[model samples]
Target: MSPQEKAGSGPAKAEICRAFSETADAYIIYGNMTDPDLYYASRFLASDSFTYILLASGHEILLVSEMEKNRALKESCVRDVRTTGEYDLRKKAAACRDASFGYAGVIEELLQKENVRKAAFPYNAPAFLYEGIRTGKAGIGVTLAKSPFLKARSIKSEEESACIEESMRGTEAAMEAAIDMIRKAGVRDGFLISPGTDRPLTGAEVLTEIDRVLTEHNDLGDETIVSCAEDSADPHGKTYGPLRAGQPIVIDIFPMNKRSRYFSDMTRTVLKGKASPELTKLYEAVRKAQEAGIAAARPGVTCADVHNRVCDVLEEAGYDTIRSGATVGFIHTTGHGVGLEIHEQPGVYDNDHVLVPGNVITIEPGLYYPGLGGIRIEDTVIITENGCRNYNKAEKVFEV
Candidate 1:
């Protein structure tokens, strides 16, 4: 088992320790409010800025607000948690004319106490914090290094996989409820009618039902798509308006667990009634292409190769990608990695990323046409040593 799996927590501390050893004398993270790296490092959610420093001398320190210091001490991964008050930031701020420079001076004093002259930070660090470090009189040198941390986060631990799987279960249940709503609706005057009501069903109503189900399971459906017909042709179109019978309806749900902070994505195209010959052909082609992509995703396989497999299957069926100026075919990449962020790393595109065990990715193949609508089949899976284990359990039936 890897160190991350053995720790039963987030990434191993040794990993961070090694980053400090190789990247610089110390590694610093300024804020956890929107930084996944800080959250990963501390294992605690902070809505404000805090300092997280890991020294090459095998020491970890977290400087948080007084209101959060006790909570951080209890919930954080690191052992040393101190409040900013302990550093006398107000007294230090009085020394510098610029408030930003004052904050940097205080941090510089703390680093000097530890004898740290060289440090590293995330490449996407906040501009204010980067400027502070650059202008501070401590003469500390900083390197923008994010690759080591991103690489560590790319391969998930067993516990992280379980969290993702649990999130997928709730997502799949919500998808089932949405499809059931469509399956039980009555067809009237070329529009789907809500059961026991004369009003026509709308995509908004379906999305409402989906969100209701997800909320019940402690998941939030953010920007869920329940598009139909022409709307479905545009991949990211918002769900709206009345639903018509015998037309393609693309239902894509990406829900995140409120507690675990992991996301799950799944999509399926369904028709209220019989589908036209052209729509049926498109659905079959997309489904086969998705299967090809999934089959090609295995340990030691390159992500580009997996994407090419899907493209080959689609092109052979007389549908080419939009990149080739074809308006109604595969327009997007095959898949992407999923974890704390909906889109993570190891993107399954025409890139050189090699698939490995513990990598969780998605395989979604789609085909869209202006007049006929769109068809997409997606499932989240984990790459194993030999193959991938698919987490999506929803059936792929076009006609409801």
Candidate 2:
């Protein structure tokens, strides 16, 4: 088995130690909060650089700057938080093999102190660190290995699920605000005007509405999708201008909680006025397909099974999907996992991964055409023992 497949959940010290011990004596990770693995293992976040180390004994160590030492101790699960000063980092921090050299030195120092002979690093390990180790210290054996953090994160703990559900509430609230605005919009000369302003409502305004509501809940909407008419044809399309009255207005919101740092995803399509007969059919097909996808997300089911269920529903409705090698129509994965990062592991697509109880994923099925515009409905859900628990409470209303 690959290292990832053999690993356990949640980046626990024992799991980390066992995950990388087959080929090396220790495992190390280096990065900032942007590195989800770093945050997951250390439970510590910082803007600047930091390092995490795990020994074969299941002991964990964290290295950070002095300014961050106290906060690391207060926030992180790692009890052995050390500042760079003790490793003689200040002197070399200036003119090392690059900025990473100084930190790499600190990492090497820790490995030596812990009596580590061989160490494995993530596949995406910092290049400068390799240079620092190769050029500065020559004793330790280092090699590239699977991080195992992704596999660990794939199965959400009860606490992680709670954080995701909390963030999902914010996403739902923001989606509610966006739909309400579109519903109350007044149509004039084939364009949607604001309810009170009498001015044409642009895609930008809808995005603002999403962000404004997310802010109230201490959540941040990063690149939320707000597209209208033909713009909606592209899944991640971002456009601006007055919304078409009878065409689809696709709004996909993904918000992350500021404090918890967990993400939630949801999407809804609405119309300011009335949808055409064909548009209505398109919307219903996507909605039904989403239902099928959700229904197939039970434990013991493979991800490919869930995706195929969605495809069957959409195809039975006379829509072309990737199954037929079609370029357009229904052209995306059924869903994906959500956690500290927006897109995590155990994708609900063609992959053959068996669904597990703790896997939190999204069921989003969409149909898009340049001429017909687009229609999509998405919901965040947790895969339960028998079935799935949906986090979204927003109704799937096609017309405003």
Q: What is the C-alpha lDDT of each candidate?
A: 0.82, 0.84
Estimate the TM-score of every prediction.
0.92, 0.95
Output the number of the TM-score-best candidate.
2
Q: How far is candidate 1 from the true structure (C-alpha RMSD, Å)?
A: 2.6
Per-residue lDDT of model 2, residues 1-400, tens digit only:
2222222223454665677888888788888988888887777889998888877777778888889999988878788889889888867677564556777787777777788888888988888786566555648888898876677788887778888988999999999989998888888999989889979989999889889999999999889999888899999887777778998989999988988889999999998777889999999999999988888889999999999999999999999998788789988888889998899887888888998888999899999888888888999888887898998888999888
Model 1 is weakest, by summed lDDT over 10 consecutive residues, at 2-11
Q: How many backbone clashes does candidate 1 have?
A: 0
RMSD of each: 2.6, 3.5
Instruction: Estimate the lDDT of model 2.
Output: 0.84
Tens digit per residue, CA lDDT, model 1, 272-315: 99999999999999999999999999999899999989999999
List the candidate 1 regions with Cα displacement exceeding 4 Å.
1-23, 94-101, 322-327
Q: Which residue pairs show collisions in model 2?
A: none
Task: Give the count of colliding residue pairs in each prediction.
Answer: 0, 0
